[model samples]
Target: MKKLVSLLLVLLVFTGTASAADLSPDVRSAILVDAASGKILYQENIDTPMPPASMTKMMTEYLVLEAIKDKTITWDDIVTTSDYGFFLGRYGGSRVFLNEKERRTVRELYEAMAIYSANDATAMLAEHIASTETAFVELMNEKGQELGMKDSNFITSTGLPRNILSDYAPPISLGEQVMSARDAAILARELINTFPEALKIASTPKAVFRQGEDDQVEMINWNWMLPGLWYELEGVDGLKTGYTEAAGNCFTGTAKRGNIRLISVVMGAKSKEHRFKATKELLEYGFEAFTVEKIAKKGDTIKGYEKTKVLKGKKLEVPVEVAEDISLMVKRDSKIEKVVSLTTVEAPVKKGQVIGSVAFDSESDYLREKDKQDTEINMVAVEEIEKASLIIRLFRGIKNFFLGLF
Candidate 1:
C-alpha cells in the first residue's frame, strides 16, 4: 500500500503539472507569510472568503491603539460600560463581567479585548471610541477598507453577535466582518508591523483587567499557542483565536525568530491540535526554505548616473546610488520574476531618494489577482551635507518658535 501510494503521488504530480498548485488537505484555508513585508510565501484556499471568528479582534484592537496614539483617547481614561457593554455580556457574549457605569481604564480594556478576547470589553471599547456600537462598527469597516480588507464588514465589535432573534440563529455567524484567510493574514501583518509596541502588551500570559477600588476580573489569554506551547518557539506573541459554529477553530499567529517575523493564518481547522500542528509545519517550512538577500544598499547612487541635482538645496549635485539594495529569497534555485521601477523616481534629488520600486514574483495567486497589493517599504532620507545659509538658519529658528506656540 505504501509503494502504491508513492507511485500514485508521482502520477498525480505529472497529471497536474500545468496547474502547478499545491494545497494541504488538513486545513480548510491557510496562508504563511513574512510579517515585515506582508508577502505570502505559501497559501491554500486563502482567498475563499470565510468567517474570521475572533480573529476579528485584531482590527478592533488596532483601532483602539490608533485612538490612543492620536491622543483622541488615553490609556488611563475611564471606559464606562453602558447598555451596550452589559448587554453583550448577558447575551452569551464573553465578558470581564463589567456592569453598566462600572469603568475600566483604556489600558485594562485593551488587555481584556486583545489578550483575553472579552466580548463585553471589546464592545465597550467600540462604544468608547465612537459613542455607539453602530458607529464603532462603521469605523471598523471604514478602517477595514483603508487597510485593504476588501472582503470584510463589521456589524458588531465582537464576533458573537446573534441574528437568532430574527429566526436566522445561524451557528455562530463567523464575523459580521467577513474575510478571506489571505486578507486576514494581511490585516494581522499590519497590526504587528504598524504598532510593534503592541507586542509588549500582547504577549502577556495573564492580565488584571478590572482593577479598581471595587470589584475586579482576571483574564488569562486564550491564545495558548504562544506562551503555553513547548517547542523551539520564542518571540511567538499575540494575535487572536476565534470559533463559532460557522467558523471552526481559527487563529492569527505572529512570531519573531531573531530579525525575521512570520505570521500564519488558519481558518476552518478541524480541531485545536490541527491549528497548532499546521502552524508549526508552515513556519518551520518558511524558516528553512528561504533567506533574505540584500541586492543593494540604501542611498546607493544610480550606478550609471554619477550625480543628480538637488532641488532648492545649496548643493548643485549629489552622488546617487540604488536607493536600497532590493533583496528577497527564492526557493534555493527557483527563478523569480524581478521588476524594478527605478525610472519613476526623478529626484531633483536626495541621497535617499525613492528612485523606483522592485518587485519579484515567485508565483501567481489563483485567487482574485485584481486586488492583490504589494508591500514595498521605503528607505530613510539621506542627508545633503551642504550647509544652509546663515539667513536660512535664522529663519528656521523663527519658524520653529512660532510653530511650537499654540
Candidate 2:
C-alpha cells in the first residue's frame, strides 16, 4: 500500500507538469483558430491590443487586393513614385530603394511588399489607391470596422513606428497602431477567404525585385517556416511576420493539412526563432488534437427539422436539408450537439433556397463563445414548391383557422 501511494503521487506530479507546459507558450499573447469556421482552438491574452509590427501590412495587402478586385487598379497599371515614397525609401525601416518619379507596375510593388516587407512599395501602393498614406489609413480603419477588428488602430500603412516616418507620419492623434491576437487571426482568415490568390505571392520564398536592372535586389520572404526555408514545415505557407522594439517578434501564420486549415498568432516572443517555434507548437496541437468532421451531409434532412411550414404553396410544407456539407473542426472523439434554427417561408421556393441554418454546439473547453456562431451552415429546401391556386389557398386558410381554434 505504501509503494502504491508513492507511485500515484509521482504520476499526479508528472501529469500536472505536462498540463502546465501545454498551457504555456513562450510569448506574451497567442491564439489558434480554425480558418474555415473561425472556431478558436487555443487563446492566451488574445484580446489585449498590442503593436502588430509589419503584420499591419496584412491589412494593406487586403486593401490592395480589394482595389484590384473592384477594378480600382490593375496589376499592370504603372504608378510613379510619389515624394512620400521616395522619402520612405530613404528612411523607412525595411525598403527597396525607390527614386522619386520612378515608375513600376502595381504587380512589382505588390510583390515587393508581400515578399520583402518593403515599406516603400507598400506606401506607394497605398498612395496610388488613396492619393496619400494618411487618407489610406482612413480606409484601413473603415475596413477594420467592417471586418469586426474592433481592437485595431492603423496610423501608418507601412507599420513603421512614427519616429521612423519622421515628418511624413499621418497627422492622426490616436497614437500607434495596435491589434489584438484575436483580431489578427480574424484579418488573416478574411484575407485567405476573400483573396486566396494573395497566397501565391506570399508563399514565394525568393524573387528578384527588378531582374537585370542596374540596382536589382534579392527579396526573400521573412516568414521562414515556408518550404525550403530554415524552419521549413510541411503545408506552411503565405502569411506575415513582424518585429519592432515595441512589438517584439510577432507572427500571424497559417497552414493547411488535408482539408483542415489553421491560423495562429504569436506575439511578443523573445526572438524570431521563438515566434516560429511557438507557432509550430500551436499548429501541431491543433492538427493532432482536432479534426474536420462532417456532422451534416448536404441534402440530408436534420432529424428533428425534416420539414417546415410554407404559405401559399401547392403543398402545405416542404422538406429542408442543409445546402452544403456542414463540417466542424472539433476535438477528436468529442460528441457534438446540433443546434438548428429555422424560419417559415412563402412558396415559389427554389430547390436550393436557404430557409434556415444549422450550427454545432460543442461542450469542449477549447471553443469560445463568440466563435460558436461561426460553425453555422445554411439549411435549404430540397425541392421547389410552386404557389398554390386561389381555391387551394382558401382551403388551407380555413384548415389552419380550424386547427388554431382546436
Candidate 3:
C-alpha cells in the first residue's frame, strides 16, 4: 500500500497541475493562444461564425499598415473626408468628426481609428488606401483571404450599419459581419507578428491630434490594459477593442515578456465587465499554466541546419535558424517535441525569410543542453557565418569529422 501510494503521488506530480478550467461563462465565444507558436492554447466555440462588430477593426488596422508598408500611403499623407466619413461622424459614430472638405494626415487617421475607435478616421484612412471606403473594404477582405481569415468579411471601414443592395430588392443593412474567434485571433496574431513597430503607438495611454479645424482632440486610448487601468503585467502593448450590439464587447490583446509575445482574443462577453474579466483570465491562464523555457541563446549553432545545402541562390548554404527566440510554454516537467523545417526559397537560403515553422508538439523543450535549462532559442543569421574563412570551415569540419568517427 505504501509503494502504491508513492507511485500514485509520483504520477500526479509528473503530470503537472491541471490547467485552469475554461473559466469564461459569459461569452458566446473565446480563444487564448500562444502568439509565437500560433497554437490554440484554450478555446471554446472558436470556429463558430459570429458577427464581429468592432473586432473587425483589427483587420482594418492591419490593412492600413499594409498600405503604409507598400508605400501606397505615408503617415503624413492627407486624406480628405468623404460623404461617408461625414455621415458617420454626423450620425454620432465614434469619430474625429473631420468635415467633408477637411483633411487629416494618415497618422492622425490611423491613431483615431486605432486608439479612439473613430469611424470617421477609419473611413478617411480607408480612402487614402483604396480611394474609397468600399474599395478599402475589398482590400481588407483580400488581405483577410491572404491571412486565411476564412470566416470574415469587411462590409465597411467603420463597421457601421450600411445598407447593401444584394441580389434581392432594396439595399439592406448588413445583417452580420461574420468572423470566428479563432480567425480573429489569427488576424490579430499576424498584425503583431508582421508589424511589431505598431506596438509603440497602440500601447500608448493617450494620443493628441489636431483635426482639420485645428481642434486638438484628446484621444484617450480605448484599450483598458494600459498603465492606469491594468494589472501588473509587463510588455503589454496596443491592440484593438471591438463591440457592437450584435457582437457584444471583444478585445484582442498582445503582450511581450522578455522576447516571447502572445495574443489573446475574447469575444461575445455580455458586458464590459465580462470582457475585461475574461481577457484577464485568458492572459493569466496562458502565463501561469505554462513555462516559457528558452533553449538556445543567440549565436548558438542550430544542429542539422548547417548540413542542409541550399540548392540555388547568390549565396551558399544559408544558416536556417529559429530567428526569433524559440520558447516552449509547457506543463512543468513535460518535454517539448520540436520539428524544424526550412520554408525558404528553393535555393540559397538568404539571411531572412520564413525558413520554416518549428512545430512544437505538446509543450516540449526548444533545445536541450547540459546543465542549462532549455530557455529560448535565438537564431543566427546566415550572413554572420558567410564571412567565415575556408580554412576555419575546413578545420571545424575536420574536428567534427574526427569527433563523429570516434
Model-by-model lDDT, in order?
0.66, 0.84, 0.66
Q: Give the TM-score of candidate 1.
A: 0.73
340-389: candidate 2 lDDT, tens digit per residue:
77778887889989888876654433323556665668888988999999
Return the top candidate by TM-score. 2
Which stretches of model 2 miss by more than 4 angstroms? 1-23, 304-320, 341-357, 362-374, 378-406
Instruction: Give the alpha carbon lDDT tens digit for every residue of 1-406 in model 3.
Output: 0010100111111245537564654678878777766766677888788877667778878888887898888889977877767766676357776777778788878888888888778777877788866677778778888877777767776665443212211133433567888788888778887887677778888877683446678887777777775442455686878777777888878777665566777778887667777777777776666656664444444455543343334444556556565445555644555444444344433465444444345242111121012232333345522344567557767988999998
TM-score of every model versus the real structure: 0.73, 0.82, 0.70
In model 1, which residue pairs have backbone atoms overlapping below 3 Å? 296-325, 300-321, 300-322, 301-320, 301-321, 302-320, 302-321, 309-348
Clashes per candidate (backbone, < 3 Å): 8, 0, 14
What ranking emerges by TM-score with the best candidate at the front? 2, 1, 3
Worst 10 residues of 3 by lDDT: 1-10
Shift in Å, residue 184, candidate 3: 1.2
Please give the lDDT score for candidate 3: 0.66
Q: Report the lDDT of model 3 for residue 230.
A: 49
